[model samples]
Target: MDFSVRTVRADEWERARDIRLAALQDPAAPIAFLETYEGASAQPDSFWRERTEGGSESGGGRVRQFVAETSDGRWVGTVSVLVERPSDEVRFGAPAKVDQTHLVGVFVRPEARGTGVIDALFRAAVDWSWTLPEPAIQRVRLYVHEDNARAAAFYRRFGFVATGETVAMPGDESAFEIEYELPRPEAGA
Candidate 1:
């Protein structure tokens, strides 16, 4: 499967929404995503259109969403990176890990899993983080539920390391979300 991984186009919001809804329907959806498929699927088409457009370059960079599309133009997976500033707002902690990108909403269709689409999507997201100019990100990070061992293994294989950080999962005392980080590059990546 020769797939092209690139920043999503504003016009493809429906495609993006479709893949997300599919991901949320997977068995591991509870551990893999923050939202339920039911919620996202119920959203109006206009909402998805606006959401996808917001992640495009024209939207001033609040979020950067990448998608993996087959050679024939079918979108199969997606990931979103949210930029964070170090001086004030911190994610999950007080110090605010300065100048970083938060990886979220990662979803690769089950049929596409293990077919290298994941690496392509991740490369797209990681590469995008390294290109930011202002506040120059120092790292890219994500949180995964401890019980989601499958995802944790993949993150480690992709060069992300556990950062000794853990956050209590809301409503789940027995399980915690662990943080993983990939050091940022000093120059254009």
Candidate 2:
């Protein structure tokens, strides 16, 4: 794909914010993202700073953000993974049963959608989950809106089997989030 997948730097908060806002403006944003572009764009610079740092290595927040940079040095895609410890509160429901990496905030620029950037970004996120040291991740998971068939298909193709887990959408009736997981590699196999 000729794209460079790498962790985002904490200092690149501005760039991060730009891409995220752009993603929110995409046609599928209503079902693909929880936050609106208007909301994100209105957030203070401090918000972006904290969010960027929280997902960067230097922040030590147990979360990582990976960006797919094109040959021209533009960030065309991004995916963030948040490590969830067993004791931590479940992101939107029950506490995690085992240590895991919860993938979120995935987005690819409209122009880069079909150029293999999504696969590359996903690989980077999944690989990072297994590479963590403290608490050692056991699995990687992501949630997709029930109606996002296009994304659901891609998740299936990427080896994230549906765990049959479902979470009701917050403050919304007749909507649910379907969970999919990527199993970790076994030791000494």
Candidate 3:
């Protein structure tokens, strides 16, 4: 593909908001994301501004969002990662026993699916995770809805193995999300 993948800019919140709304409208959003179109659409512009900036390259570095933009300047896909720490007051899934990155908000425009965009976006996200300073991120993880076979298969192909942990989906407790992780490659191995 001719698209370029990079961390989002703090100043591009509008674009970020636009792409996210598009993602929430995808047919699989119910299984793929925790937020709904109605909920997201109701958020004020300030909410999106903070949300985008929090994950931008110039943001605090605890989170990052990557986007694939075509040569014509259209964003075709996106993926976001949040740093999780053992001492954090809140937890997304199981408390992090070690520093880790939680991958979320993965999506691609239908027309852009299966064209290598997802692979490139993941490379950016995971590679960024490996470069964290200090103790260094021990692993990168993501949760897939139990019934989302397509996402699970792709995650496996990308080297994420189930850790045998499952968390009830936020809104639908009847459904669950399975956790997957890719431990950092050992140095000099």
Question: Which candidate gets the maximum TM-score versus the true structure?
Answer: 3
Better of 2 and 3 by TM-score: 3
TM-score of 2: 0.95
Each candidate: what lDDT? 0.86, 0.88, 0.94
lDDT (Cα, 0-100) at 185 in candidate 3: 93
- Please give the ranking of all candidate structures by TM-score, highest first, separated by commas: 3, 2, 1
Predicted candidate 3, C-alpha RMSD: 0.9
Q: RMSDs, each prediction?
A: 2.1, 1.3, 0.9
Least accurate stretch of 10 residues (summed lDDT) in model 2? 87-96
Q: What is the TM-score of each candidate against the true structure?
A: 0.91, 0.95, 0.97
Question: Model 3, range 1-189, lDDT digits (tens) per residue?
Answer: 579999999989999999999999999989998899999999999999999999997789999999999999999999999999888755568999999999999999999999999999999999999999978999999999999999999999999999999999887889999999999999996
Best by lDDT: 3
**Candidate 3: misplaced stretches above 4 Å?**
none
Give candidate 1 regions above 4 Å deviation: 87-95, 186-189
Model 2: pairs clashing at backbone N, Cα or C within 3 Å: none
Candidate 3 yields a Cα-based lDDT of: 0.94
